[model samples]
Target: MRPEDVSALALLLPGVVEAAHQGHPDFRIGGRIFATLWVEEERVVLKLTPGDQEHLLAEAPDLFAPVPGAWGRRGWTNLDLWDADEAVLRDALLAAWRNVAPAALDGD
Candidate 1:
């Protein structure tokens, strides 16, 4: 999928807002970042659950991975290359919300 497609799907989550700073794209809910992205080099980094990084790596080793440095151990996965469809990203992003955001903040 394209970056635009990812952004579009992310916006579907309630209360999600797109903001850019430090040249990175971030998705926020309740004024907090649920997902952050770096489009340079065609990569989208998602702040995910600590339990999910290994699962994603084991399942889609090539497409999903942990973010480098401190986040790598905490389950932040990066979606490298826009090679997948919106469905995949949607699920991943929702997972991120489930981890970092309160359900109340992500309305209908």
Candidate 2:
């Protein structure tokens, strides 16, 4: 999916907010970012669950890759839009919520 589509889908989550600071799109809950749309890079960086993260990278390293810099070793993954679509993109947002939101709110 395109960045704008991801931005729209992100808004469907509860307590989610969008902010444009430092010239990039940030989707947050409780003032913390769950996903980000890098305008310059045309990429969507999402925070995924630890177990889910490992599974995706190990199973489909080509479709998803680790985010550079901070959080690389944590639960962040990057999706290249060349082969991306809304269904896969929406699942990425769900994964982002699992990483950024609290376990109490995630329903275990």
The TM-score between candidate 1 and the true structure equals 0.87
Winning candidate number (lDDT): 2
lDDT over C-alpha atoms for residue 105 of model 2: 72
Runs of candidate 2 with Cα error greater than 4 angstroms are 103-105
Give the Cα-based TM-score of candidate 2 against the true structure.
Answer: 0.83
Which predicted model would earn the best TM-score? 1
lDDT for every model?
0.77, 0.78
* Stretches of model 1 off by over 4 angstroms after superposition: 105-108
For candidate 2, the 10 contiguous residues with the lowest summed lDDT are 79-88
Q: Looking at model 1, which ten-residue stretch has the lowest summed lDDT?
A: 99-108
Pairs clashing within candidate 1: none
TM-score of each model, paired residue for residue: 0.87, 0.83
Q: Can you write out model 2's per-residue Cα lDDT over 1-108, one digit (the tens) per residue?
A: 577787889998777889875678889988888888886666787788667778877866777888776686787888775577778777878888767787777787
Which residue pairs in model 2 clash with each other? none
CA displacement after TM-score superposition, residue 97 of candidate 2 (Å): 1.0
Model 1, CA-based lDDT:
0.77
